[model samples]
Target: MISIRRFPIRIALCFLVSFPLWGCASIAQWAAPEKKATTSAPVEFVNAEQEFWTHFHAGHYDRIPQLLETYKRLYVLHPDHPVIAARIGFLHVWHLSERMRMGEPKASVIDDATLCRKFFGEASQLDPKDPRFKGFYAACIMAEADIHQREADTRKGYYLMKDAISDWPEFNLFTGGYVMSQLPWEGSLFDEALEWQWKTLDLCAQTKVDRKQPEYPAYATQDFSGAKRACGNSAIAPHNFEGFFLNMGDMLVKKGEVPVAKKIYSFARLSPSYQQWPYRNMLEDRIRKAEENLPYFRIQKREEISSKNPHLMFHSEAACMACHRTND
Candidate 1:
């Protein structure tokens, strides 16, 4: 029944040189396993949330599949845990974000969208007070709409995003604005998104800070303690401040306000995370050639660029990985 003739040259040589003796020795070792080097203690089970955050902050996106399995297994034991559900939901979206950046086929997104919608919707229900859960659920709905070409779901998702923004202006303003940013830049919806970014910056600055200044490097030094978690820099989202300005500047550039856009882009440099941010060169280049890069920033002409290029806010790691990964 065995077919040694089909084996590779290396395997044939091994068989010819050391077959019977090696096989006999392997069988003997397999049957005789009485010796013990030492006794080991069982690993202590850590808090699920703590473990998730540990891996997340370490930029372990590649381990997401394993992480998902671990969470799902734990979810069965703690069915009421909103944090667990939200983590599951976020991971699904994170995976979807990766697939999108890689230019994976649209058909591959359905499973991720479905699971994302389910867990986030569940998280929103379980923790009704946390608007972030609801916001993510609404975003998942919008994603499903795009996947399935459902117009009614589109309207429902938009209205839900609007409501979420009203409920928590500082956090949802950025989140909801990000969802709206996918629209064509020429539309009123895009303008509203741009307005939301201004509102976000205003809220982020608890004290009166000049928005018209040519440089606001003080943003890097300001106190973000009182600001909402999404509004400030943290281990969870190390580059949110910088990413926000990068997005705001690109919006201004698309609207043909090159000088204003350059100033807005400068805000990104003010963030302490700028040096660690892998996309710092992209922002620097945009600031230096704001006028020349205007056409490239517009939504209409993005098709001309490669799908793999991280050119815009939504398309770039700024949307997700910049918050999770140390390197792209």
Candidate 2:
């Protein structure tokens, strides 16, 4: 029961003609009715869906398996509900592929790539052209690329990412394309990666503008929040605040911004979220060395010091002799 709007040409023309004079007043009146209607109805959902969202927001990753099982039971009772199917499929990717939480000890679970493939495949089959399904399917392909990389099948990974980019152009698929193009191929991959990065950046900029348009889908709005956080807002400063700073700092170090990079890397070392990341220790060591060498590299120049002392002797030996002469 999605709402669709249609206006006859005559009505549209009249509305357009009157819009300048009456638009604000009409919008105010329309808003009251909408607000009343929204407030009159109680928000309700299937008990399992409610439970799933509750656990999700609570960060109960360890309990996701049990919650998912309950969702499966509800699904059996309501096989025709595409929304529920989509939710379950999306959660499988969030927990399995994204590893939104750490895995449990001794729990033999299916790898993320396989779980993502199965769920997204089923979801897309159930509801073709559902943008949510397409987005999740793209995610599954990207997860598979990661799995392929781990298994040393770089060619398979690259192709999978390329297919994902082609299939889900709206969901930052160019990022996947960029990653695929950057696979360690004896430095031949740089140009390909740069091409994809440029394409991705351009697409993201266009998508950002489109999302601000009034007619964009609600799902797009939701997905765009995370994407915007990742790419758009400079105030949030992703590398400085998130777990990304460590890697970014390392890149800066390699680019020769030693002092500023070390400061950033030092902050990353102290971030609790990044404690388990592989680069934590390396960043810490780099910070220590940078701090230890700060005095030598950052000391005031001898010329500047000498300029402040107009009558001081130029040579070290002469200066020592002048101080030690003791009014002789």
**lDDT by residue (tens digit), candidate 1, 143-198:** 88877889999889889988888878888888777777766778998888878888
Residue 141 lDDT, candidate 1, scale 0-100? 88
TM-score of every model versus the real structure: 0.75, 0.42
Residue 244 lDDT (model 2): 33
In candidate 1, stretches whose alpha carbon ends up further than 4 angstroms from where it belongs are 1-47, 100-106, 206-220, 227-229, 289-293, 299-305, 308-310, 326-328
Pick out the ten consecutive residues of candidate 2 with the lowest summed lDDT.
Answer: 319-328
Per-prediction backbone clash count: 0, 0
> Model 1: how far is 24 from its true place, Å?
72
User: Which is the leading candidate under TM-score?
Assistant: 1
